[model samples]
Target: MSEFRITGKAKLAGVIGHPVTHSLSPVLHNYWLARKEIDGAYVPLSVAPDVFVTAVKGLQASGFRGANVTIPHKEAAFAIADEVDPMARIAGSVNTLVFREDGTIHGSSTDGFGYIANLEADGIDVTALANRGPALLLGAGGAARSIATSLLEKGFQVIFSNRTAERADGLANELDAAWRRHFPKGDAPRLSTVAWDKWEEQLSELALVVNTTSLGMQGGPAPDWTPDLSRASSHLVVSDIVYVPQETLFLKAAKERGLTTSGGLGMLLHQARPGFKAWFGADTEVDEATAAYIRAALNKR
Candidate 1:
């Protein structure tokens, strides 16, 4: 590792969360800074929910370039931003915040972009699935909102399934409205909600399956059951937004069935690109070396 040093005039960026001690964002950004020899510093700040707004304002006042917003702060970040990107508007959240020269804050959601980018990084041609068939989304939380919006925008019909039927239905309705308002008339995507217990019945009709919940993450509950991929389409792709274990049981089952699978690490890496550029005025690339570095670090945890 390059022993990069911090100077008084270094560009500043960070991540804001209620409990940020476990975040790898600082490691990701600092790696790029050291590699490029940029005079910048990226850190993590633990800010309580009540003081999030005040803390953000203070960062802006302190000449900090920008910060990544996580957890409870994404929605609040959107509300405080002077300008919001279209993706952020669609997702109703913001993970990246940019402080401009005029002292105004700009917010954007890179989660959707990161999702797609991660698929592409894994050699999955997501564009080829456009109009191919419906996709199965396995959650209705914030992460699912972004992935659902992205799938619809990419021309795939979405089937939302969540443990709470009402939440799934509500998310489908919200996404439908957002889809209509964002896309052209004929390009509008179709969305439907499936009961949690009935998700398995619809599996055969899907070409892609995405798990956006914490069910498979470390310390989270394991899935009650695994889908039988043998009966599903051979072209089906299984992806999970949980990367802590690197290979969740959901992904391992898919692999065992000779199906394509993608983990969440790429999303974490790809999502950091936009924020880094906004803060340091340089574009960063997520290459194999970077992935190896992160994987090694994750393995050590």
Candidate 2:
């Protein structure tokens, strides 16, 4: 077993997920605590899907302030929360969970916030750009759903551009946005499908592109996106949520074009800030130094 290192602080906050060890939340939260000189501590707790209920209940029962959920447990976190933020309710998943003093759980998904942060960190003006052009979102999973949910409500023109037409259409319907079977040719930023063979063909006109698919993660094949995207992206903002690798091919292409590019790391850091504030207080920002180190460490890995 690894050594248990504890910083002396009475208050407890943690992140809950099956593979919680890989999370950077602890470093972010503890860094905030250290900076603020607050007498609290945060840690990571590994909890399997089947044990979610018990694990969450146990945290609430203890002095634990709250926890963040990741991956397979986001939906479970939402289902078990006593109350959920409006955005989280719409997203149908919760990544940032708060265990309140009243034994009530307040669930929220920060995936969108994180995605937005990734854009901002990479020098993209998220608020300005999202409002200006149509965003091509690439997946329909919980993470994509949350990001689309937020972007739509924010009045951004987000279109579903996934390979799987049915799921993408369903997500668009749920969000009350537009959807289609395939990317319509000849202009008009439309929400539709991208045929497996036609991704690169549409790269020239995209204003912003997002990759919600887990394709670039775990040493897998790169995303089947368009070529010269970086050059094409000179007029676009390109981002991907695959943070395991600091630079994915998707962003690499965008960077090559000198376009605005962002990685998944910023989103990880930004999304946790709101949750940490909810767990502790609004006065806290994620520890920037810690977060920077975490990013560096991840890049090195």
Candidate 3:
């Protein structure tokens, strides 16, 4: 790391969340800011839900570049954006925002991009995986939606299995409609749903399985819960989006079985690249050093 310094021409950005004291955005973004040696700052803003809009307007007025929205503010960010990318509109949330010189705000959801980018970064051939078989997503929440949309775009058959079967069905239908609307003449996306408990039985036919639920987070749904990967094919790729413990139990089981696996940390790192570029005018790459920096930060907490 180099000595941190900023001047009157420094670019400014931050993250907005209701209770954002724990966000790693500052750690991740500031690392890139310093490594690139750009006169920019990325901070964390703990704003109440009611004042999110006002705070955003204030940032814009102060010539701030942009801010990332997390948790409860993702939807609000989408609502306030002057324009949004298709991913954000389809995902129903926004995580990255850019304030243009013309005073317009643009919002985008990088979850999908990060999800696929991380897999590719791990040397998993996504296009070949899509050709192998369908992908089974364990939860149908926001992360699942974003991942599903991205997979569907890449010609993968996406299957959803959530604790609530109805929610999975609804997500499938919503995404199906959106996919068709986006590509009316293109092939309709292969989307389906399976019962939560039966997902394991069908793993043999899946090329990839992702746990988008918090089942394996350090303080999430279940401390010791992990999916049964016994029935998964030898080629099945396992992934989890919960990065706190880095190697979630879900990923552990897959690793123990000798199957390829990807953790959530890479997604977290890659997801910040787009925002970093938009805010700092630099393209950042995630390599071993970058991963180690974030891993050290997580270990500290």
Candidate 4:
């Protein structure tokens, strides 16, 4: 890629987290800036929790386009945003922020968008998957909620499974209530909770099995916790949202079982597309070249 030239008129944006030096957003955005030949810059901002609000205000005052909120700052971003999209409100977090000319910050969560975009990029028709059967989401955290909401919106029956049964139940109930409030008499989205230990039992009836938990992540809570997919149907699609190691254990097991699988890297790339356009006013593609670039960066790490 060519070197990016930042002039006085450069568009400014970044990613914010407490310890953000490890973020690859700079690489991703900078690559796009250089590729698009735009006078823009994307940086990483390490802001402590106590000063999140002050830092965000300072960024808005300094004419920043916006920034991607990461880690512990997502909730803070949502709280401080002057306006938020419905998905951001439902997810209760904001991963992307846009600073408007009126000095107001707009926030939205792109995790779900990214997740579905990645699947589509792989030529896995999400709507078709929904039609095939329900999706079994293997977690109840923020990521799970976002993915579940997306699946539910896509006409997929969403069943959540988490280590803590209460967390799973609560998330199911919460989303169910939200759906009802939004579409009073509309067809209720199928939302249910399953025991984490017994999620494998639902394999035959599921069209997709997603691991939104940190179980199979590289340095996550349980890196070795890949599930047995011996009973998975031939048409089942296994997906995991942990990208550090690229081919996570969960995906590995699915692949070994001769089932289709989607990894987290695609989701990461797809999710950043919206924020890139919002901040730089330029459209970017998450194609093979972009994926290769990100993979090279990951290999170096």
Compute the lDDT for candidate 4.
0.89
Q: Quick one: best TM-score, which candidate?
A: 3
Q: Pick the candidate with the highest lDDT.
A: 3
Candidate 4 regions with alpha-carbon error over 4 angstroms = 1-4
Model 3: per-residue Cα lDDT over 1-301, one tens digit each: 4465687889999999979988999999999888888898999999999999999999999999999999889989999999999867767789999999999999999989999999999999999999999999999988998889888878899999999999999999999888788778989889999999788899899999999988878987696887778898899999999998889888888999999999999999998999999889999989999999999998998
lDDT for model 3 comes to 0.91
* Better by TM-score, candidate 3 or 1: 3
Reference-based TM-score of each model: 0.94, 0.82, 0.96, 0.95
Candidate 2 local lDDT, 185-235, one digit each (tens): 423323455653465566666677788888776566555544445335457
Residue 48, candidate 2: alpha-carbon lDDT: 89
Range of the 10 consecutive residues with the lowest summed lDDT in candidate 2: 177-186
Residue range with the least summed lDDT across 10 consecutive positions in model 4: 1-10
- RMSD, model 1, all Cα superposed? 1.8
Query: Where in model 2 is the C-alpha error above 4 Å?
Result: 1-9, 177-192, 223-233, 282-288, 299-301
Report how far residue 120 has shifted in candidate 1, in Å. Answer: 0.7
Q: Scored by CA lDDT, what does every candidate get?
A: 0.86, 0.72, 0.91, 0.89
Q: Report the lDDT tens digits of candidate 1 across residue range 21-71.
A: 888999999999988888889999999999999999999898899899998
Clash number for every model?
Answer: 0, 5, 0, 0
